[model samples]
Target: MSKQYRILGVIISLAIGLAILPIKLTSEDLHSGNLFLAARTIRYTFTAGILAFLLHLYLNRTIFAARWIMVEYILRIIVIALIICLTSIVVDAIFNKFVKESSFTIAKEDLNWYLVILRCLLVSTVQFFVVFYLQLVEESQRRRLEIEKLNRSQLEANLSNLKEQMNPHFLFNTLNTLSAITNDVKVKDYVSEIANVYRYMLIHNKLNLVLLESELSFINSYLYIIKTRFGNSLNINIRIDESILPTKIPPLSLQLLLENAIKHNVASLDSPLAIDVYNDSENIIVSNSLLPKKTNYHSTGVGLNNLLNRYQLLFKQDIIIEQNTAVFSVKLPIIKS
Candidate 1:
């Protein structure tokens, strides 16, 4: 048995033993009889207490089916009753042999041993049910917690897979943009910048979170490629607090938001699409003026969905999205270290 159970057994036994003392001392037989008979009564009460504790400990370790519960309890009651009766008889025999002048007896006429046996059975039955009920409740709670943990683990795995899929799509789009550049010199420089962007993606994609500063540096490399392609048509502004540099965010989160703005909106010499990145007390805000393309561009919104799922897994905070006829905005929470 565990140490905790051992300690509990000792405590319960002592409590019952002490509670019987005053009643035994006030009995006419015990008060009038010599000190020897009084001592024996106390010993018997303590022995019954110990026996009740043992029965409780034994029943806790044994398992019974629902159909067999009553049968098992009846069996326990019979066994404890027999043990208490045998103990009383043995102690009486020993006392009688030592003190022949005043022979102590637990005989039916003298001491009513049946009542003592009945009390032992009752206490044992009550203690067994109390412990059984507590164990049932504890096991049920343990199972519930395990199920919740399993569900959370499965969700995290799905979000990680979604984030990893973005890498290939991003590489494909960057390569497609590079293919259209006509200037050989400009193409060579853009190729170097694209290489740096890919290197960052490969190194950090496996991680759940990255420092905001590191992600911003990667965004700068990505913006270089975008600025080369769109020229004066795209205008991106950034205003972030240096104190929040140590904060963490999912990798490529900002890049995905900026890409979404450029994908759906019109950005040309006549109508420049301006995107702004800034931070508030709790979140990093990405906003842009809405000027949707005249021609329909098939869009799936996979990137934004992937970001939302990733944030849900990493933190409890929600990613806020707001839109109107004139502008669109998304707020990403900054995870503190």
Candidate 2:
């Protein structure tokens, strides 16, 4: 959420208050010295502005939590605004009907619900657009700055990468040689899958997005390596729509989820771990039954956090997480084709 949005709410309300002040004044009213009318006009205008601004801030904070879907966000804003407007009118009507008017809540006859709601809606809608534009600009600038920082970091690491990087060509050649010379067919297949996993990482590490099919293919190879290590103790089921094959996602994103499940859970021949990857209407879901290992496991949460940050920065979407004693699930939004 933007701190500027919160701070600007009061400032904008004050501005609106002042803007509506001139409309409140008339030559005859000023000449006649209608102090009560003057005070009521100013009070009502400022109160409405302040109320709307506060509501804007609260709703903006609540709804726009790392998930910046434009359509949904705008719809929510409009819906909440209408609700607040209607609620205000009903409350005012109730107060007028039941409560005695003294110093405050005076000039009930002068209050026009239609005009007041219209004015509030107009001012609030304009202010919302202004703040939303500012937020978008701030986010764009922040993203650019981050990208520049990452570029600088990559440059600094270039020398280290050169020194530490194993030549992929040589590694592939060696793996192919081992696979060719292996006496056992299973060992040959295992060697080939290991090569595939490494090759996918080397090829797609720098890419921002890859087709789901490509990522899933890489995952299959990666899973082969894992299954070889865990044997029948681990089972992975992936059922994705073929139509979604063209959809894009951050490369290696699913690997992080799969890795987390394998790392944290108890997977043995008995009570084998089951990890399921499937897709619904708009999202891909990864789910597993809850099975915590007895051994103390320290979690830094880097993998999932890294995945989350990438999605927010790249897609402006938040991954939905749901967990219980029985199952843990994450719904990852799929990028449109």
Candidate 3:
């Protein structure tokens, strides 16, 4: 109902309670102290107070969970207003209809809704501040956690970039120096290939994602070095469609996978390691034969973790890794051009 009408009803009830109620109840009724009247007053007061308390708890628990505090606060006010207004109406109706005295006539003042609304606003304001303060504290704590996380991520990204720069550039410069000193064509070409691999890394390491074709070119240079190192013991195959070459992935992803496979597995002439690279409709698959070395190779999970972090940061996507008795494989998601 409209506020004015609600106020009008309260004014009419106020006229009855103030003017008529005194005329209805004389000094004799007041001195007698009727047990029924006292019981009802206690019942209604306790019930209303308890209901408001419960409502406050309910609203605090459920409403404060929302992201926007103002929205929740407004919602609480609306809800509280409706509940209190409706409850006052119900209680007043019950009291007037059910509770009767033989001394007074049928009609008498029941309740003053204006007073109820005032009390509701007062209680609502108190609870709002309490809940709002708690909400503020909670939000402050959440923001602090987020800031801490962001700072940690920034530090890690800086560290990763540092690693990218120092490792690659050092190798690149070292290889260039070796190339200058080399006399033989085979040694010079090998050094050049290694330089090429490091150069590719230095150039693309800053990028969030690289086109598949560019990554594959880097992989080609990287594979040459691996092949030169391992010879016939490593059989690495690539069979990716040209259509998906335009798709994108985090830089160093394939290289990391290849290095992970080579690092963790036993590559020997007696037991050659077979690594395969191909693409399905959704993902690029990297698979290698499982041949664990007896030697304790420290598995820090740096390479795969780096790839996972890069992909998640760039695209909010996860790379799939699977292994069994025979083959260990990873599926890198393809981000379309």
Worst 10-residue lDDT window, candidate 2? 152-161
**Backbone steric clashes in candidate 1, count:** 0
Q: In candidate 2, residue 330 scores what lDDT? A: 89
- Estimate, for each residue in 1-337, the C-alpha lDDT of model 2 and write its tens digit: 5676566766776676567534444454455355545554445455556666666655665554456667666665566557556655666566556645443353444466666566556656765665676667777888898787545544433443356567889989999899888899999989989888877877777777899999999999999989999999997899999988999998778987998898899999999999999999899999998898888679987667667767776778899989999898989998995
Pairs with steric clashes in candidate 1: none
Model 3 clashing residue pairs (backbone)? none
Q: How accurate is candidate 1 locally (lDDT)?
A: 0.74
Between candidates 1 and 2, name the one with more favorable TM-score: 2
Candidate 3: tens digits of C-alpha lDDT, residues 41-109: 333343344444446555666545457978877777767756755775676566567667533322244
- Per-residue lDDT for 187-257 in model 1, tens only? 76787778778777777866778999999999999999999989999999999999999999987789889
Candidate that scores best on TM-score: 2
Q: In candidate 3, residue 4 scores what lDDT?
A: 45
List the candidate numbers ranked by TM-score, top first.
2, 3, 1
Clashing pairs in 2: none
Q: Quick one: RMSD of model 3?
A: 10.7
Local accuracy by lDDT, each model: 0.74, 0.73, 0.70
